[model samples]
Target chain A: MFAEGPSVFSRFIVCLVLSFLLIVIDQRQQRLESVRATLAVVLYPIHLVVDFPTTLVRATAEKFSSRRELRAANERLRAENLELRFRMQRYQTLERENERLRALLDTSVMVGQKVLAGELLAVETTPSAHEIIINQGVRSGVFPGQPILDAEGIMGQTVHVNPFSSTAMLITDPRHALSVAVNRSGVRAIAVGTGSMAQLDLNFIPNNADIAEGDLVVSSGMDGVFPAGYPVGVIEVIEFEPTAPFARIKLRPHADLAHAREVLFVWPQTPEQDTPAAVPATEAPAP
Target chain B: MSLRNLRGTLLIGLSILIAFALTVLPLPAWAQAWRPAWVALVLMYWSMAVPERVGVITAWFIGVLLDVLVGTTLGQHALGLAVIACLTVIYHKRLRVFSQLQQGSICAGMLLLYVTLLRIVDRFAGVPVPSVSYLTVVTSALLWPWLFIILRDVRRKGGVR
Candidate 1:
């Protein structure tokens, strides 16, 4: 026995205007961010509930793993740990030497960054956006613009942070770009995401630049977002178009963007606060 | 109010929740492009079935929820779904009487409109629109018949007049 107060068309127009206002507010101003964040807290439980089934399946699979498989995995991990320890020893010596050299040159020593490990909760379901939600968020000291890395290299940056989770835009997202340098020749360039998971495009590199097909690309840290010297990607293709002024260079990202389950949130060292004083007396003579 | 009506509303709410979960379920890389717009389909179903109960305002609210869940620009889905709800309310009688196949075609058209609107919003927001996203409309349209039948059964069993 219920009839409408307003006609469907009138309601549609009202709602349409309201939605337009929302879109404009969300896009042009950051005013809606607090609302979104508050709503995200409410939405988090739904995510956890939706993910419960997958977590159950994984747990069951782990429970059913064979003894032989477990032993083999343990052995492999132990060997890997030994190898990492050996490499770490060499790295420590090199780090000390580099510090001494920096002191001699009257520059600050590189500050080590702190990292928070985060597990990927979900990948964005939209085919257009390459983003992932990680379990670390504002409560975990994650902030927007924090650089995310996998074991291999820089993966992306956090775009939004809720209380318990943050959304990270992958380096392969078309809107994302980072300043990078050729690890071999130190030629600076900007690598932009191509909207494809497999490739990133280097923008405006001259054809004469000493970029090889397999040169490593590392973050230049010029943008002040990503820390310096982390591997970003590797050059996969370099096409010289006779008509085009710039070379078309594509890169395969070093981090496994599609399949990475865990990522590192880097707390970059603030230069002014963390930089070691440039004292000449601290310099040790090179052997 | 009445227990029967409450049951009907609960059924509708449950169906929407299931649809949202399906929308977020992980698909293999190759099949990701073909994901059906589960939430849109559910919204269309309810709006068509019970315009008074599930109208443009309800569609707008659900659309915003979907937007948050999918992490898209806010109100993008609200705009699309509001239009769809309006159209469905206007043509609910005709759409109900049409053959299943004809209704499926109409569903495809609505989904295409939604996709196109979303793509335009994405362009303005500076997110890259993937060509494969168009495939979702086709997949959603193709799945309409089964979704329609299942939802209709639930409506009938719940006595949701």
Candidate 2:
């Protein structure tokens, strides 16, 4: 083969230098986000092509289900709906009381929270990074740092949002950590992912902390990323040593992090940022 | 360019698209790590077969596409695939003379290097890429000989050269 225009060695060196610069830019947070978003739009077709087969099989399976299977599913949903309605009734009264108490305290009352439902894209965005893509993107108002959830509880937060899709890092990713409080005792601690979907490690929890095995863990809302009171995990194990400064506490996350097919993108900050303050100011001017 | 050359180029693009498609198709839970790294294997074949066309630039751009596909940092795959392409170019003459088994062994080494480079870059980027581990190395190596045969047959039949 004849030597090409630039020669292989020169081209290789150029590409290496260029890519090294790109990785540096990409690693510094959102500096490369706009470029990624543009490139992601071009690559969107690749994702669609890759996703076709999985969605097709899923759709076909749902369509070809037997009447008995459909009936069983319908029955289960109906029973679940009834149970939810009972809980809804109780929550409605609690919500009214919460507003009255807030009015007495001269604090802004909590409004109904908003969430956007999204299906998990079939692509494993980053297998090692514990990143998952969702079909919702910037077009649907999805934004970075939005908390993600499943039916059970807090899952992760969106790290990058493209035009057609968004990538979320799961809470179990080693790069991620969350602030959580023990629901029973309100002890605050940092929960760091253990690189396993099934477990998270709580840091700086003293041996004498009020937490016990089976204690419920919920987000503390202190970090401003995840809202307070969402179920995060249940403590499964705690080991203490006499010489150690902190106990080793293991938690099993409530969200089915590994298997969830649907996720909810929550608007926790939107409430305070857009609703209560603006509503009163606009209404008072009319009066 | 002649019709044959154009068709050959199309075939290269098509094969890669198919590899990308295979990547997103869900595997059974236990078989996730066992699935061969399709893109790596495809690039290994192409860089060796047509080093003139699929050189470091092509490999780097394809790596960029993969980065977007998998949501990694922009240049992680680019750097890894570039290394693979560069090595293949430097060794293409000797590689052509080698038997299938020998070629596959070298391809396995390249694949392992590509994966390891990715993990190292991922570590630098603050993403810990454990769990999948080096299992892909074994699977990609196992798939190498068969993939080489199929691609070689297709290239010859289609007059890709």
Candidate whose TM-score is highest = 1
Residue B8 Cα positional deviation in candidate 1, in Å, after optimal superposition: 2.6
What TM-scores result for chain A when each predicted structure is judged separately against the true chain A?
A: 0.90, 0.89
Interface RMSD (Å) of candidate 2: 7.8
Off by over 4 Å in 2: A1-6, A106-108, A271-287, B130-132
Q: What is the lDDT of residue B58 in candidate 1?
A: 90
Model 1 chain A weakest lDDT span, ten residues long: A278-287
Candidate 2, CAPRI quality class derived from DockQ: medium
Error of 1 at B55 (Å): 0.6
Any runs in candidate 1 off by more than 4 Å, and if so which?
A1-6, A270-287, B130-132
lDDT of 1 by residue, B65-159 (tens): 87777788889888989989988988888899998899999999998998898888777765655423888988999999999999999999888
lDDT of 2 by residue, B91-158 (tens): 88889899988887898888888888888887787665542357888888888889998999988987
State iRMS for model 1.
8.0
Clashing pairs in 1: none
- Interface C-alpha RMSD per candidate, 1 decimal: 8.0, 7.8
TM-score (chain B only), all candidates = 0.95, 0.94
Task: Report clash pairs, candidate 2.
Answer: A125-B70
lDDT of 1 at A137: 88
